[model samples]
Every structure is written in C-alpha cells, then in structure tokens.
Target: MSAPTTHRSAEEIGRTLAGPRPLPPLGATREVPLPEVVTETLPSGLRVLAVHRPGVPMVEMRLRVPFAAPGSVADPAFTARAELLSSAMLTGTATHDRVGIDDELAGVGAELGVAVDPERLLVHGSGLAEGLPTVLDVLADVLTGATYPEPELLRERERLVERISVARAQPRTVAREALQRKRFGDHPIALEMPSGEAVAAVDPGEVRALHAEGVMPRGSTLVLVGELDPAEAIAAVGKVLGGWTGAAQARELGPPPVTAAGPLELVHRPGSVQSQLRLTAPALRRDEEGYAAYQLANLVFGGYFSSRWMENVREDKGYTYGAHSGTEFVPGGAVLGVETDVASDVTAAALLETRYELGRMVAVPPTADEIEAARRYAVGSLLISLDSQGGLASTLAALDAAGLSIDWLRERPVRLEAVTPEQVAEAALEYFAPERFTGVVVGDAEVIGPRLRALGGVE
Candidate 1:
C-alpha cells in the first residue's frame, strides 16, 4: 500500500504564502432599478397589480381576500366552514370535475393552491409565461362557481379532522395555541387553527354559503409578476376576471386587543423532553417612521443567527439548538416575538439568559458596529427577497393586503441606510426590554416548575 499522503491542517491551508492575507474591501453596492408596476381596480371590484420581472419565463400569481369571521369573537362554525371551503375550492366548478380541472391545469403547465387563516384567504399559483391566461381563467371559474360537491366534502372533512388532531398534539402547535390565548384571550385572531370538533361539523351547504358571502371581489387583491408586459398582464387579468362580480365587500380583519406585558405563563406538558420559551411584545409597523431602526434593532438582538441573543443563549451557554426573534405584523400594528426550544433541564437557565439579553438590549443598547452589521444584513436580505418573480409576487400581494404600495419596497434600502444609531437605541429600549414582554414556558411542569418559579419572572 502507498504511504499515506501528508495532510495539511485547515489552518495551514487557510494561510497565504505570506504571514497573513489582507482582507479585500467589499465591493460598492449598486442601486437596483425597480420595475414599473401597472395597477387597476376592475369594474367588478377586484384590484389587479402586475409587474414585469423578465428574469425567467414564468408567471406567478397571488390573490388575497379578507376572509375573517365577521365578529370580535371568532365563530367556530364559520372558522370550520372556512377551512372546508378552502380545501374544496379547487375540487370542481360548474363545468369541470376534479380530474378535469387537474387535467386542464396540467395541460397549461400550471398549478394552484388555496389556504385560509384568521385574517385572509389566499390563492397562489404559478405557470409558464404563455399559460397566464389559462391559469387566470381556471381561477376565475373556480372563484365564481365552485360547487362543493358532497363527495369531496366528505373526504376533505375527514382529512382535515385528522390533520387538526395530529397538529393539536405537536409541541410547536401546543405552544403556539397557548401563546395565542395568553396574548389575546378570545380574539378571533387567536384561533389560528380550527379544532377537530369544529372541522367535523362542516357541511357542503355551509361551505358553499361561506363562498358566496366571504369570497367577494371588493377588498380583495390579485398580484401578477412574470416575464411579460405589465400593462398587458393587468388588462388581460381584468378582461378575464370581469365576470367575478359582487356588491358585497370581503370583511376585513381588525386589529386584536394589544398584547399586555406581564408574568410568563407556565403551561404544563407532563413528561415532555423539551421546553418552549416564547416571548412577545408590541413593535412598530412598517409604515411607521423609524421602522427601519426597529428592524435593525431586532436583527442585532435575535432576528438572525449571528445575533446577541443567539450568541449568549445558544453559543455561549449551550441552551438551545437555535434562538430567534423577529417582527410579526398584525392587521394594523406589529409585534416582536423571541423564541427558543431547549431541553427541559435547561429551561430555567435559558429563560434567565433570555431575560438578561433583553435587559442588556434596553440598558446598554446596540453599539455602532452592531447597527452597521444589522443595516447591511437588512438591505441585503430585502434585495434577495425580491430577486425572483415568485418572491416579488408574494411580496406585492402581502404589501397590498397591508394597504402599502410597491413604492415602500422600492425606497426600503435608502430608508434602512438612513436609520440613525439613536433611533435603533430608542427602538431597542422601547421594544426589547425584559419587562416589555409576556409569554409562555411550555414543558414538563414537574421537571421545570420549581426552577422557573425560583427564577421569579416566570409564574
């Protein structure tokens, strides 16, 4: 056998032939030009936004309809019907059976999906550029005339029931449910997922009725992005979907009761192997002034893997696999949520470190280095998010839902660059203080309860 080759150590390989290689300067960032968007509201009341993104020969579409239950407290019956409606929406229309619908979509190299949450119903689709008409036509056919056949309803109801049962048992799902209830007592937005019993009660007639009442044209938006002319795409969409008419406006979801900062709720999940540490507090909205500062402060704290909280809680202390914090927008305002999962044994220690980081964020505030790093990351990530037609389409749809236009996105980088260090510090103090948050600690109470109670912030 040949003698084993002498191996170079990683450090030796990394060395230049010199003592140490000098780091090259970063290339200057070039300003990216945004595509001009075409927008119009059809006579039938559907708002259409189209933009050209000729990077690839594909088209992406997104439709957002405010589909919340029209009340302060969510009606479980309506929530269940909405779930069943979304599942059955693409099953068939007046002229096509389920397979026929599939065959037609496949013929055009297109596919579509529908989903519902407490806030809105979304229909997202993608296809070859040449097949945009077929996609829109099929979408219109379903939106205007979905007949929830009994057979499909029976099967879908069973599947949904099974899915809900499985989801309710998942640790993440249980934590989220507990957190929602802890944050907003009985608000409709807290009902993120329907219960199994609620889903089982859905019937075809009720689903069809919800389709008639909730899936209207007004207060809804459709966004199209692809390798095509913007004006031509907008006109085509309006022409094709002109028949989807209704006088009733889709009900909009109002903002929930504000999250109050108080003691951390301890929810017992006996014999659990891991504990979930979830914390949340109110933050600024995207449209608000100094929002960019809030974004940078969030990044410096725990919005990215290289954040302070991640360094302290996971890297230094070995408390978790990962830790994350980010801003989540609601109907009107926004909130910052920080969360991590750790072994039950380390639950108390993790919570302690988490609170320490939060207190540091408030008292010491982010340094200039941290602010610059976060700003660079914020600008880079924003550009990356819009680099694809699908991403652009999705972003536009979400912005429209929030009553913001593409101009906000186009100016985002400049806004981020202009955020002052003082603003970031102010945001940190206002949003990331330990006392500003309330949340839940979910795990085996018997294993974690004593230590958490000793920690004092957690109840």
Candidate 2:
C-alpha cells in the first residue's frame, strides 16, 4: 500500500472549483397533433365518426346507444331484464347462430361484445382494417335482429346471478352501493346492481322487448379509427347500416339531484377487519370554465399517489396502503369522490386524519411545487390517454355521449397548461371545504361503531 487511504467529507466532494453545479433546465414537452376526422349523420339517424390513424393495420369500433330508461322503466323487472339483454344480445341473431356469428368475426380477427349501465348500452369491437365490412355487417345483424334464444339465456342468467352474489359480498362494492344511495337517494343511478332474485326472474320475452324499446338509432353514435380513409369509412358505415332504422330519439337520463353536504352515514358490515372510507362533494363539469383549475386542485388533494392526502395518510402516518380522489362526470355535472381502506383498529384515527387533510386543503392550500406537479400530470395524462387509435375511438364515443366533439379533447392540453396557481387555490377553497362532503363508511358495527359515533359528524 502506498499510503493509508483517507475518506473525504461529502461537502468536500460536492464543492467544485466552479461552485455548485446547477441542475440542467427541463426539456420542452413535445405535443402530438390530432388527426383529421370525418363526421356525418346517416339517413337512418345514426351519427358516424371516422378518423384515418394510419399506424397499425387494425381498426377499433365503438357504438353507443342511449338506453336511459324512462320513468316507466321503473317496472319491477326492468333493471333485471336490461342486464340479461346485454349479455344475451350477441348469443345469436336471426341471420346466424352463436357459433356462426363467432366464426365470421374470428375469420377476420374481430371480437364484439355489449355492456349496459343506467345511461346507455355500449357495443365495442376491433378488427383488421380490411375486414370493416364484415364487422359492420355483424354489428348490424345484432342491432336489428338479435334473437335471445332460451338455451343461451338460461346459461347467461345463471352466470349473472353468480357474479352478482360474489360482487355484493365485496367491501368495495358494499361501499359503492351505500355511497350511491347516500348521494342520490332513490334516483335510478342508485340502483346499480339488481338483486339476484330479480335477475333470476327475467325471461326471454322481457329481454327482446327491452332490446326493441331501448336499442334505437336516432341518438346513437358509432366511431371507427385506424388505417383507413375517413370519407370512405363514413360512406361504408352508411351503406352497411342503412337498414338500422328508428323513428324516436333515444332517451337520455336527466341530471342527477345535486349532492348535498351533511353528516356521514355508517353503513353496517358485521365483523369486518378493514373499513372503507368514502367521501364526496360537488364539482364542475368538463364544459364549465372552472373545471381545469378544479381538476388541478383535486390532484393535489388525493387524486394521485403523491398527493397531499396520500402523503399524510400513507407515507407520514402509515395508516393505509393507498388513497384516491377523482372526478366522476354525471349527466349534467361532475362530482369529487375520495376513497381509501384502512384496518378496523385504526378506523377512527384514519377518519380524523382524513378530515384534517380536507380542512388543510382549504386553509393552507397547495404550494407552488404541488401546483406545478399536478398541472404537469394533468397535461401528460390527457395526452397519454389519447395516444393510441383505440384510445381515440373510445374518447370520441364518450365525448359524443356528452354532446362534445373531438375538438374539446384536442384543446385539453392547452387548457391544463394555462391553469394558474391562484385559480387552483381558489378552487380548493371553494370546492374542497370539509363541510361540503358527505358519504358512507363501511365497517364492522361492533368494532368501529362506537369510535365513529364518538368522532361525531358520523352516525
């Protein structure tokens, strides 16, 4: 050894002759430009939107038919019937049996399916670009002439009942049902999952009747995006789906009752080890001017993993594994919801800290670092969500349902970039105030009930 090695202090190693090196400035963000789109309404009253996104030789398709049930839809069997109809619709059509239908789609590397909610029934599919005609023809066959055969219906009905039973026993599902009731009272939106008994009672006649009544063309939308010519695509859709005719405009669910501020309701779940905490308040819709700022404020609150709520409740205190807050767009408005799950032993402690974080959102608001991070996330997420052809197709269908066009989506990046810290602070105070939130807590009554009652503002 030449000499004994001596360790240098970190400060000595860090200081350079030219002084501390400053961090390199951040690079400018690259923005992806949107492609041109062709939009038109066919003679059958179905709106068609097509875009030429020439990347992969594949195409994505989305069809949205307004299936909002009228007041008369409260018929005891209506919800059950609607659920079964969505599952049974693709089992067979007049032109082809179930196997034959699948074979046609398989030959073209295509898959199609339907799902329903309180608002609409969405038919989604994808296929090779050259097989557009085959896909459209299959869709048309189902749309106008699906026959809910008894054998298929019987099998699907049993599956539905089993799924419903398993889902209801879940903690998250229990919380969702309780939250829906608290927020909407007796509104149809609160009736998300039909009882197992109701589903078991549905027969083929009810499903066919529901399809004829709800699956109309006038207010429906179809979107196709991939390697194709937009103009040709629109013409093809019109020619293929020309026979899908309906006279009346599809009904839409009216705006839900405004969420009111009140005390928390304790929905009892017996002998639970974990408690689900959910909270909700009013928020601005996407079309509203203040929505951008509100969106940023929401992120700083609990919308992301690094958010203040997460930092306090998870990193700092170790009370829960994860927490979240998000905006849900309803018919005419939007709402903010915060959710988390914590062990029953710490249920009261978690609630106190949650309320404290909510109060701090209004009192202290977010710092410059928090605001900048949330704004950047908002911009980056919007761009990423619309980056692919399938993503773009789905976005178009959802926007069409809300009476918005793709232009609204293209401008979102700029809108998020322009939101100022002052605006976010104002929105935090206006909307995130603790008094404005009301929701349900799902946990064991014997374990958490007394602590929750002692906490007050909870019953």
Candidate 3:
C-alpha cells in the first residue's frame, strides 16, 4: 500500500481554519410569548388557574397539595404514610369500590396518575373536554371520601415494601440513597427510600389520617385546568370541590437546613465490580436570581450529552460509559450532583477527572462555541416541551404551583439566550465548591477505601 499521502502544508491547514463560518448569536435576544391564562379562587380557598385552547377536545386537571415529605421527619413510617395515602386515594371511595372506579374510568377513557415530589403530592388526570365533569366528580369523590380499606391498604403496603427491598439490592440505588441520607441525615428530604419494615408497619388508620390532614383544599391547594373555558372550568371545580371541608392542620416542616461543609463520605460495598461515584453539594433554588446563570453553567458542564463532562470523561478518557450532572430545585436550596460508574481499576482516576472538570468550570469561561451550543440546546429543548397538550398542561401547572408568573415564563427564552460566558463562569464559582461536596462511592472497600482516604483525608 502506498504510504498515505501527507499533505503536510501549513498553508493548507491555515486556509482550512480561516474559512468563513456563519455563527449564530451566543444568546437569545427575543422572548417567546406565553399563553394568556385566567386565575380565580373558590369559596373553599382552592386557587384555580386555566388556559383556554380551542382545538383540543380534552382538559387536563392537576391538584397540587402542599404536604410534601418533610426533611425533619425521616422515620420510615412517615415516608410510607405519604406514599400510601397518595396511592390509596384512588383505590376506593365511599360510593365507588375499586372495581367501580376502574369501570367508570374505563367508560370515560380517562387516565389518572399521582406523583410525589420533595415538597408536594400532585394528583392529576385527563379526559375529553365534555367528560371533564365526570372526571372531576370521580376526583372529588376520591379526594374527599376515600376510605382506606384494611385489606387493600395491606396489599399496597406489602407491595411497596417489596419494591423498597428490591431497590436496596441495586448498587446505583444504594449509593444514591445512602448519599441522600448522609447529606440530609434525619431530614425529610433524606428519606428517599422507605424501609420494608416501615412500609409494612403502616396501618389503614394512619393512611386515612394522613390523607385527611394533608389533602386539604384551603390556601394549600392549587387547581390547574387546561384547554377549556376558564369560567366553565372554575365553576365545575368549585361546584364539585366546594363541599369538601377539612380543618386539617398544615405541617410546618421548613426547607432543609444548609449542609455544613464536611469531608467527603464513602459507602464501601465489597464484591462490587463497578464503582458508583456520587459527588454532591448545595446549589441555587429554582426561583433564585442566579438560577438562569447557574442553569447555563450546568448545561456547559454536564446537563447535556454533549457537555464538557461527557466530552472529557467519556469521549476523551473512556474511563466510564457515561457521566452527567444536574440540580434538583425544590422548595429549599437545590441539590447538585455529578455521578458515574466506572470500572474498579479506574475509580480513583474517574474521581480525579470529575473534580478537575468541576474546578475548571469556575476557573475559566466556556468558549463562544460551547456557550452558543448549550444555549441552543436549552432553548430548543424547552420549545419541544410545549409541543403536546400534556406537556403544555404540565408546564403551566408546574409553573403555577411554583408561584412563577406568566411573564416570567414568557421571558425564559430571552433570559436563557442573554446569559454570557462570564456569567456562567461566575455562577460556577459562586455555587460550586469542590471541598464542600460529599463524595459517596460504592465499590470493593479494599480497592477504593485507601485511595479515597488518601485523596480526601477521611479517616
């Protein structure tokens, strides 16, 4: 074979680099307008917000309850109570048994789902616009008249207990859960996984009590109805939920206390083939002034697949299959995390590289190319999030629950586009501190324990 022809001319290389490149702007200059929505309050103190869209034949309903699992109440009993009450709400009501509820829902072709977050329980459902009244009736019945049958409650409790037991067996789950518990330790937020014993210990009476106390329709509740006439939707909701009365005491579990700076902690699991590394620290809340800047900085670092973390850790070094970082913005300060699983042999190297990348973020501004790509991806992903009825409803409902105004939603694109590279760098410096992070690694203790102790000075 002929030697591969090497056109080793510096002039050719320089010409290639000097070629014209039409680059887009670094940040978005224009704002996308948000939909106009109406808001009102019901006699029962339920806050209702609605957005009217003519073409869709369906309405999305979401009920936001303020009773999120508190960080201070880490006992497995409370954790199990929160989850079981949310699930059992739909299993049966005073008038409709489980079978009846299922048949009625099938008849209307409606779907109901529940989600429990760090700070709230969201009961949401969707149905045809004309069938909203039926759906609402069912929702009201479930919320107001749910009777936690002993047999059904026992079944769900046992099922959840089994699920928790299975989750404990996975290394990734173990590392994440252990890190959360250590970070928040004894706080409600740290109770990410309920113990099987705790799940099994919950009785029907406790489920009913938690439900009655937590799911009150006072200032603590938000009703978001989408793709319907605002007046009509509000009227329907008020009529159905008006009679729902409860003097439930709202639990005043405040936000998680700021974590004290401490040396990294490692959870050693022997016989593990891969090392699961989790590096975490405190970060900005969703509504913080620096949120926009921090978001851009995270994108440049590891929020996206094409981010710096992935490029350096996976593409360049091949130390691990993948690595990424993100921040969860709850009622309290956000939790920032960078996580990955690497072969046991390269666990230490992976940790060093991750720390290097995190430190580099604060030391230097991202290149214009990197900044533009990150902004584009962030804005483009947001636009995609608005493409469906459910997506639109979800976005609106979440924003409403978080107390974000429509104007803020409308201006999100502009804010994202206007973020400068220097702003991202500053955000990184302000929010991320390598020494303050808690590093939890699950692997063979013999292999990683000594290395971690040497690096982190942990005895």
Candidate number of the best TM-score: 1
Candidates in order, TM-scores: namely 0.95, 0.94, 0.89
Rank ordering of all candidates by lDDT, starting from the highest: 1, 2, 3
Roughly what TM-score does model 2 have, to 2 decimal places? 0.94
What's model 2's lDDT at 369? 90
User: Which residue pairs overlap in candidate 1's backbone?
Assistant: none
The RMSD (Cα, Å) of candidate 3 is 6.8
* Per-residue alpha-carbon lDDT of candidate 1 for residues 337-367, written as tens digits (9 for 90 to 100): 8999999999999999999999999989899
Sort all candidates by TM-score, best to worst: 1, 2, 3
lDDT digits (tens) for residues 1-459 of candidate 3: 888887766656555565844556555547654567788877676778777765668777777777765345666677778887766777888899888887787787787877664567788888887788888888888888999887888888878778778889999988978777757777777776677887777889988988877877775554544557788888888898787766653453457766665666667788888999887888887677878888888888889999988998899999888898898655556788889999988887888888888788877767778878888887888778766667777777667766786677678877887788778788888766577677578888898777777776343
- lDDT score for candidate 2 against the true structure: 0.88
What's the true lDDT of residue 325 in model 3?
A: 87
Write down the worst ten-residue block by lDDT for model 1: 25-34
lDDT of 2 by residue, 1-459 (tens): 599889979786777899975667654344447897789999888999999998899999999988776772333467788889888889998889899899999999999989888788889999999999999999989998999888999999999999999999999999998998888877776677788899999988889988888899898899999989989989888888898887888877777889999999998899889999999998998889889899999999998988999999899999999999998888888889999999999999999999999999999978889988887788777778888989999988988888887788778867777878889889999999999999999999889989999999998
lDDT of each: 0.89, 0.88, 0.76
Q: What is the lDDT of residue 194 in candidate 2?
A: 85
Tell me the TM-score of model 1. Answer: 0.95
